[model samples]
Target: MIVDKKNDATGVLLRNGHIVLPDKTYVGDLRIRDGVIAETGQLEPEEGERTLDCSGCYVLPGGIETHTHLQLESMGTVTADDFETGTRAALYGGTTTVLDFATQFHGESMAEGLARWHKKAENNCYIDYGFHMALTEWNADLKSEMASIVEGGISSFKIYMAYKNNMMLQEDEIYDALSETKRLGATVGFHCENGLLIDVLVKEAKARGNTSPWYHQWTRPPVFEEEAITRLETVNALLHADHYVVHLSTADGLDAILKARSSGIDVIAETCPQYLLLDNTRYGTEMSEDFEAAKYIMSPPLRDKSHQEPLWDGLACGDIQFVGTDHCS
Candidate 1:
């Protein structure tokens, strides 16, 4: 079992392990003092120092989870894991830091949303944590609050182009918010899906007597995601804003991003493991009850298997910058 060496004043030495670095990997020793790495390379144990023989083991840096949704409430249900349970699980899996979305619900101030999240996480996280304020509503007052939010240490913000009547902002609002965030030198991330089109599609599906989980994927196709992404990128290009696309899951969407970046748009993107490893087939599976497919339901729902390779390729070529779990639980 691994041990916690946070209070080891005399320091702890990890010897004879293969250390993985950005550009190279080599067998070496790493020494830690006061809970931080103090040195590396060939080293002998000093008096009062605790040494661990790490033969045949590999040492790597801790992970930073770029997206998470701990203790979040949605659709009249709260997530299964709170900040305490979620962060503890993250730590167990080697994530050292997590950036969670502090959502500002409609009709609420950004500060109130952030304060609610802080209350839930202040004494609950097991690892370092930060917030990316998600602005569900935008206005002159909300725009003014951006500065204070930044000053309070939130350098990133999130907006949704989907979830109309709930978390989504209009195109003009998104453009204005992006402009404000850009002016403040902060990055904005987006949930890009065509909420309006989705609503129409859902209604059409239900009218046709299709109410199964399979209709969930059928109603929100890849083109909706592509359309929303293209729209966001077009707006950002006009503003030259540094922005991010969260939970990107389609080849069409990736193509839109690639085209935008080729023209020098300052946009970055992230994808979840679900998109990389799973596909829409999960929704059509004839296993258990049809509702079983609900387990895989998420925005920008999984695409066809044909789309997976492009996503993997995007990651390998550095077109996609992060792989977050979008860990709702």
Candidate 2:
């Protein structure tokens, strides 16, 4: 296990291990004191300091989970895990920092929404946490509010392109948010989906008497997300701004990001473990009686089996930038 700087005065050391960093990994001895890294490489423990044998283990920085929904109220249901439970679980699983969304409701101010999230996680988190403001209404006032928000420590903002009738922002609204945030040196993330189209499809499916949960996947196919991502990137390219696409699930979507990058757009893709390990097969079929599949249901829903391997390869070749759990539970 890797030792992290959490307990400031607890002296902990890991002996003989491979340390992983952004550019390379190397054999070293890492030590921590008072919640700070005291030394690394060719280090001998003090007379009474504690040490753990890490001969074959890889000592890496704490995992930073970039996409998670804790204490989130969505889809007419409150997500099961709140900050207390979620952060504890993340720590147990080796994650030390989490960036969760502070969803600003349609009529509220950004600072109000951020403060609400802060109240929820303050003194409740086991590790560090950062909030990404989820902007719904983009206008002159909210654009002005973005400045203080960045100063308050939440430097990233994201727009939803997937929940049209809900939290999703429109084309012009998206462009406005990106432009304003970019001007503030803050990065924006997107939940890409052609929400207008999917909204129509969902209505049509329900009109035709299809009410099963599986219809979730049936209505919002990969094209919804892929197209939305491409559209957002096209807009972003015009702004020449740096942006991140969250929970990217489809091979086609990755292809769009790759194509944009080829033209000099700084597009970053974040993929969750579910996208890499799960696929549409879990939906079974219209005749199968496994409503349990709802457990796997999420936005940019799982893709085909054919896309999984390519995601792994994308990670290996730098086409993809990072891995997150998109942990909502």
Candidate 3:
């Protein structure tokens, strides 16, 4: 965890690392020159070079954080972290890059939306960042804009199955978005959940006086998400396009994704730390003492304790390909 004061030409030698890989780990050394890796092996430190002793520590690539929401205004509340603090946190966690969503609200221009995210991040962020436009409202003109966006250096897109009233795209609209992405040779990621079903469940919970933090989980059960993923898998089959599911929370949802993949559906599964570690028990805690459990209330709410082991097992077996914090703040 130490850095050297030597000049760029001198380069710092990171000595004796427990290097990690997809399949294994090994002891090695890495050389950094002018802020980039120059060499790695049983490297001998150059004369007068700065050196960082990484003895007994793991050397790994800076993580590529694929999901984050910074400086986002949603449901009448601004998120906790802005670009500066969010990227700082990522760097602290060993992530050097982030791919955050740049949202185009209903009736907003795509160019303007991308520009706004840029202004928030360009000079202010502490680490590298990129944007994935969340296509909230799609139409003929907006669909045509996809090509220009890709040419402008942003390629992937997103659609929400939740946020039906505000950000969600229906099944047909979802197809259209994925079709456009396929035409542009790009991919579309979805927030999988039946927004309509969730709405009904939420109202039911409220009418029954179940307004505690726990009510959020009741409104969006595992089947709600599993249904959405199942539906999207069918559509992705027809379109045969590049696709992804974001923040997959339930074990049943993971089961659906694995089924699709096993059947040769080319799709990526992305899950978050909350799903892998936490559970709906937090809601019960919030109901009892810690009112802050409401803070844990998010779309595709956490599942039962039984889901935790399955999600971890899925990650271990490669059914789930990657992980993120889903760091909205």
Candidate 4:
């Protein structure tokens, strides 16, 4: 392809290979100008500044990872990966964008929490990134602050059912937040598990001298997750809320979502590859040490293999619409 001198172009051609376009791929040459795909055709013009000759490799768009926690200050320590290191690793793994969360602290303004997160992330990220507000608490001020966050292009909010002693809100608060988000046309996400039940079980396990990583899964079993999802769904129904369930790890939890969606509640649920592939057994085995245990220790703790097939089926059938990394580094 030839262009006029005024039409300055930097051309790249991936010849004789599949180019995964929006709808389908075709064997052809692709030309770029000013970061936009200028043209696609045979003998694509080479008014080239630079070019990559993809003679036989698959050409695909970069991936988007929606859920990640890097340098996240939670439960008394910062996350293992800082923004620079984590974003570098994400780039190495082919993810070009991340939707990370900005967590609000109790007794602090949401704006301050967002600014804190931004300061931590702004200069360190290598690729594009955005924020989702994680509401550690819901008060009248924070509820009103949600509108400003939406206006600022941060439109998604998250809450938890699990981190009850610290981050989780009560049922009434959850209902209020969900209802407010519905009116604001924002999406709400949840970390759904029963913290109280898990705490009691953990205490009992420790009393029995079962304090290893394996006991982590045993303490906060899958039933707690299932029960939390059911409860959250009921609260959402009462408010007619729109929500996205994040990192759903158990069969029963996903089933509650499936049942809710079938009944016409706008509850969108998702799971990560780790949940589909890993199991609770790891906590007992590989992640038995203190630092190691902390690494694999996440809320909605990993479930056993019995939950795997249903999770995969949910993905295949579109019951689970999105695949996020849940990549907390």
Best-fitting candidate, scored by lDDT = 1
The runs of at least 3 residues in candidate 1 whose Cα sits more than 4 Å from the true structure, single-residue gaps closed, are 1-6, 286-291
Model 3 poorest 10 in a row by lDDT: 1-10
TM-score between model 4 and native? 0.90
lDDT per residue as tens, model 4, 201-288: 8889889877777767777778787888888888887777678889988888888887887777888887898889887766766336
Residues 1-329, model 1: lDDT tens digits: 12344577798999999988899999999999988899889899999999999999988888999999988988999999888888889998989899999988878888999999999998777888989998877889999899999999999998888877788788899889988888999999899999899988988987987776767887889999899998998787789988999999999999999999899896899999999999888887533245568888787787899999999999999999999999884
Give all TM-scores, in the order shown: 0.94, 0.91, 0.94, 0.90
How far residue 158's Cα lies from its native spot in candidate 2, in Å, is 1.0
Name the regions of candidate 2 deviating beyond 4 angstroms: 1-10, 16-18, 21-28, 41-44
Q: Pick out the ten consecutive residues of candidate 1 with the lowest summed lDDT.
A: 284-293
RMSD of 3: 2.6
Sorted on lDDT, best first, the list reads 1, 3, 2, 4
Clashing pairs in 1: none
Clashes per candidate (backbone, < 3 Å): 0, 3, 0, 2
**Which residues of candidate 3, in runs, are more than 4 Å off?**
1-7, 285-289
lDDT of 1 at 45: 94
TM-score of predicted structure 3 = 0.94
